[model samples]
Target: MRQRRWFPPLALAVGLFAINVVARLIIRLGFDGNDAASGRASIIMFAVIGLTMAVWTFLACQRKRPSDWLLPDLVVGAIAALLLTVLVGPFISGGEPFKDGAGDFFAQIWLYAGFAIVGTLLGYWLAVLLGRDYRSRALKAFAERSKSKPRKVVRR
Candidate 1:
């Protein structure tokens, strides 16, 4: 049976949201009422998210073309995850989404976007440098195949 096109993006979104949920839960339960600690934890959570995205991108680039995965999978998933994190994540921490004001809300969005972009770039660049990305691997295979096959002679 063929897999659905939406499944991968949806799965990725859910995984990213789960990470947010866990981080929110930890902050709520363990760092509640501690402003400094909460700030530190939030930084750590964002860092984790960035690292997760980096690893995810690295592995994905190995198997699929960026054109194939970048839009349909990564962007969709990241957007979904961003929405969930912005709208639903606060509830996990026992708070409303906009309780901290619009500025803070926008700040969160910026942070998420910045980290995601940086992570993705880092992952893709690393894969390209290592010649492990799909394009690199495909080119290598093509070169090997051409080398193995001899050129045919043309009849006069």
Candidate 2:
């Protein structure tokens, strides 16, 4: 059976959101009344999410062009995940989205966006540096193939 194109991005979003869910659960159960511990756990969770995106982006860049996967898969998935984390994640922690006010809500969004962008850039840069990205490999192959063929001389 053929798989749908949208499936990947949807799955990516769900996976990212699942990370958030797990973090929330841990924070809720383990650090219920401790603001400091909850803050530390939240930071760790965001870092994990960023790292996940970095690894995902690196692997994706190896198999596909940036134009093919960046906005559609990575950005869309990040946005979807961000929405889920912000809107639904609080429920898991037994709190409302706006319980901490609009400032905190917006801050969370900003942090997610910052981490996502940085992670993606880091992954893509690493791939490019290692010459493992699709474009680099394609260019190297083309150069090698061209070098192997002899150029024809024009007859006077």
Which number leads on lDDT?
2
Instruction: Estimate TM-scores for all models.
Output: 0.95, 0.96
Off by over 4 Å in 2: none
Q: For candidate 2, write residues 1-156 as lDDT tens digits.
A: 116789868988999999999999999998899999999998888888889899999999999988989989898989999999999999989999999999999999998988888888888899999999999999999999999999989999
Model 2: clashing residue pairs?
none
**Candidate 1, superposed: residue stretches over 4 Å from native:** none
Model 2 root-mean-square deviation: 1.3
Clashes of each: 0, 0
Summing lDDT over every window of 10 consecutive residues in candidate 2, give the lowest-scoring window.
Answer: 1-10
lDDT of 1 by residue, 36-89 (tens): 998888888788888878888999999998999899999999999999999999
TM-score between candidate 2 and the true structure: 0.96
Model 1 scores a C-alpha lDDT of 0.90
Error of 2 at 130 (Å): 0.4
